[model samples]
Target: MARETWGTRIGFILAAVGSAIGLGNIWRFPFQVSQEGGAAFMVMYLAFIILIGFPAMLAEFVVGRKTELNTVGAIRDFAGGYWQYLGGLFVFIGFVILSYYSVIGGWVLRYILGSVTGGYAATESAAAYFGMVATGTDTLIAHAVFMLLVIGIVALGIQQGIELGVKVMVPAILAIFGILAVYAFTLPGAGEAYAYYLSPDIGYIMQNWQSLVPAAAGQGFFTLSLGMGVMITYASYLGDDKNLGIDGISIVVLNTSVSILTGLVVFPILFSAGVDPATSGPGAIFVSIAEAVLDLPFGRVVGLLFFLTVAIAALSSAISLIEVVVSYAIDEFGMDRVKATVIAGVAIFILGVPVTMNTVFINLYDILAAQILLVLGGVLLMVLVSWLHAGEAIEELEQGIGDLGSIGSLWIWMVRVPVILVLLVSLYLGVTGYIDFLTGAFAEYLGTL
Candidate 1:
């Protein structure tokens, strides 16, 4: 059978954008901004996105569109030899990420239902309410439901499954977010939130650069969906006529816009409620937003829309992550799409069981998948495209964009040197942090013994 291709250029762009915009943008971005000194982290993140993220994205695009294969086959066909194993790492990263990611999606789902029934709004304490639903039997059921939803979408094939779903969900996501942002602007503390969110603190960044750099870089890579073969898988469905450069730019722009918009909605609501945004930690979105909505006149409506937006965004990104492994199975093993999706979905759900049982596992899985694996996968891809297969990669890149000008060489040089250097620094910091965490946990356990 011939491989599936995207229905139109717009469909391809929307699908890629959907993958880029996920929980990382809506759920995690706010806490990261609040913790990293507001605009300081945003400044560093945007710098990395433009400098490293865009270039790394195009490198994956070149590999995918050139070979017209999944990540595993693409690498093996293009570079040959033991390097094929590196593509497997990308697939594993996607699987690992989606495991815990679905748990958060489940939380969003419960919040949506709670909005309609006034279940969560009536609670006396936001933290206590969140604690009740964030883990245990209910969370496990939600995780399974979210995974099933993801599997169903992927089983439908490219045009009907992934493309069509994003075509609707992405537009709805953008529109709902816009509505929320407008509402947030009328809040009492909007001015204070905007100042804090938009103002850069150079002094703080200089002092906290070591820790903040890796955090910002990780967020940049995570939000863009760069390192987990998502871009590669999406690009594989495109024809040579499609301009990879333009598509990549569109994904980055739209994804970043959503991230900023999320901060607009989140920070304003929290500030208006006279709450500290960073103190809530991972539960910030649920706790802060739930409390904000509970006190408003049409609290139920606001809560419903907010959680619905989050659910849609989460679903869109989850589809892409599962598709990475499903595509690999279909291309390499010649498996049916439906069967592949089901098998991959089940395995990922089983892996997520631990995450739902303990919140600590969520943080551990996130650190491993987002901070460590993503940076390593991204840097390897840069090496593969820029150094290992520089000639062919550039040739593939120039196909739809016309003659090779100075910009082509510049992109290549950027990925080869500075991009790799930044990723290596981020990777080093991530590993060191994980080790320190482990050491601290061990010492604490020994004290109890």
Candidate 2:
């Protein structure tokens, strides 16, 4: 079967960026930067992006473009039977990720409605708001509804599913975020938030070096939708005419900018409301930022805008993840888009059952995603690009990027050696207990009592 292709280069870039600029950027970056020390981590993270993330991304791109294959096929062609399983593994992880991911997107959708109805405005307490979000049967139902919307979009095929979806969603996400940041900066404690985010803390950096290094790198790769087959899948539709390196750099810049901007908005609200940085947990934005919103001079408008923007950002990524599974299914198996989407949706809904039933599922998912899928996937990609298609990779990277092409050699080395070592070290830290895995504040509060 001939593979489907994206109609326009811009469409492909937008779709790829949609997958990259997601919950990782907005949902996690704030709490992470707040705990890890802001600008220090950001600086290291940018270095990782250029040194490791960009190269891994191009590795995925070359495999996709040369083979015109999805994650599964791309691996099979290069590495034969042994490695193809790894690629299938990536596709499966993307599927597993989308399931629970959309559930969080459901939280965003719920909050968007809450904002419109002023439900969030009446709440004074973070715990109460977070409680209202969780432990409610309604939340699960909302997740189901959100999943169906994602399925519907994926059923539309590329031009409609990914292309048009991102086109509208990306602009909306940026516009709302820009407005929210402006309003946030005007808040009384806004400068404090900026300091909290921008000021370097060498003590924190040194103490958390082992733990934070892996995290920053993982997020750098994950934030840009690299390491996973999502980038490979998106770039398969990429034409040889455009400069892949330039396009990759643009996406990385845009994704990183949004992540930083989200931190600018979130931490200020957090600092302004005097929320405990250590305790914000997985739902920190909802808790800390929600509390921050209620304290604003125009609290209603601010909270409404904040939650709605999060919803849009979350939805855009969810749609792209769904499309990754949907596209591979239709193209590889010769199924119709609708049949592919429905099966993919149903399978994911079942997989997400763990996320709904177990609180530990969230941690398990995050840990496994980083250690197993993300690290392993990235390592495999580097090997394929540098070892398997070394010559072609050099040529493709040089084609569009001009003088910048020379850095391509260094990128390959970093992605192949340093990147894997860092990921392995981080995975070991989690497994061996070099540091405690403290994600929320409840434990500290409990200790006080």
Candidate 3:
């Protein structure tokens, strides 16, 4: 059998963007913005995306296209020897991420149903409702259901399944969020929310620059889905004619737009309801924001749209996460796509069971995947592409980017110096104390009453 490739360029671009625009955009990004200094964080994040994220993305693309293999196969084939372990490390990272990621997907699915049934409407407190829902057998059922949806799409193979799924999902995500943003702008306190979100406080940034830069840079990598092998697996299917640099830029632009638009939608709704935007945890969305939505005119309808949009975004990203492992299985072991997807999905589902049952475990898994492994994977990737395989990476990049004369060298140097340095700092922060900070925050939030 022949290897699968995307049917069109737009399909590939949308699929990549779909992977990038997940819960990170809707649930995490807004919270991070509020916590890290609002507009100051946004400015720093955008800078990292351009300087570090885009170049690193191009490096992944070059590796994938050069070898036409999954992460394991690509590294082994391209560099040979001990480098294959790095590939296996990526697979491990993807597995760890999807394990807990599906649990969040399940939560989003529950919210989608809750919005329609007014499940949240009857609750006296959104926080209490979320606490109840976040545990027990019901959460496990939801997680399984969400995992099965991801499996079904991935099992259909690349073009017919993953590509087709994202083609529909990505458009729906943008349209729903766009409509919600427009509606949010009409709310009573929208102007204040917009100012809070868009107005950068340089003094705040200067005072908090040490902590803020690491958080923003980590988010930049996370939001782009750069470190987990999703981009590498997606790019492995690409042909030589496509311009990877241009596609990388497009994906970043679309992903950033969705994230910014989510802030536009979420902040106004929270501000209008007199809810504080700084409730910077999972509860912010499930409890605080949901409670706010219930109080507004036509609140049920708005809630439905919001959760539906999140559900789509979650599914789009979950599909890509599963694909990273599935692609590796197919490429390295020559396993059947259906078998690989089923085995991987079931394993992830089983792994997520504990996460659904225990809030503490859930936080641990999230910190591991989001903070530690993500930055490690990114730093290793930069070293591989920029240092060890620079010649081949540049050659692969030049294949489609022939018209750009000096851009290839510029990309290489950027990856080698600025990108690698930033990723290393991100990893250092995560290792030294960031995990403790996150764990402490989770403890404080979860321990209350």
The sequence of per-residue lDDT tens digits that candidate 1 reaches over residues 1-449 is 99999999999999989988988899888888977889888899999999999999999999999889998999899899988988999999999999999999999999998888887867778888898878999999999999999999999999999999999999999999999999989988899999889888899889989888889889999999989998888899999988888988999999999999998888888888888877736777788889887766566798899999999999999999999999999999999999999999999999999978877787788888888999999988898889888889889999898877888999999999999999999999999988887788689779999
Candidate RMSDs in Å, in order, are 1.2, 3.2, 2.0
lDDT of 3 by residue, 1-449 (tens): 78899999999999999999988898778888878878888888888888888999998898888888998898898889998888888888888878887888888888888888888777778887798778789999999999999999999988899889999999999999999999998999899998899999999989987777777776887789888888988999999999998899999999999989999999899999999888866557767678899888889999999989988998888898889899988877899999999999999888888988887776577666776788888888889888888888888998877855577788899999999888888778777655676768778988995
Arrange candidates by TM-score, descending: 1, 3, 2
lDDT of 1 at 430: 90
The residue-level lDDT of candidate 3 at 197 comes to 93
Number of clashing residue pairs, candidate 2: 1
Candidate 1: give the clashing pairs.
none
TM-scores, each model vs. reference: 0.98, 0.92, 0.96
Best candidate according to lDDT: 1
For residue 185, model 2's alpha carbon misses the true position, in angstroms, by: 1.2
Residues 207-293 of candidate 2 have per-residue lDDT tens digits of 778767777766777788876688878877877766887788788888888988897787777777777655646676777776777
Q: State the weakest 10-residue window (summed lDDT) of model 2.
A: 432-441
Off by over 4 Å in 1: 444-449
lDDT of 1: 0.90
lDDT of each: 0.90, 0.74, 0.86
Query: What would the TM-score be for candidate 2 when compared with the true structure?
Result: 0.92
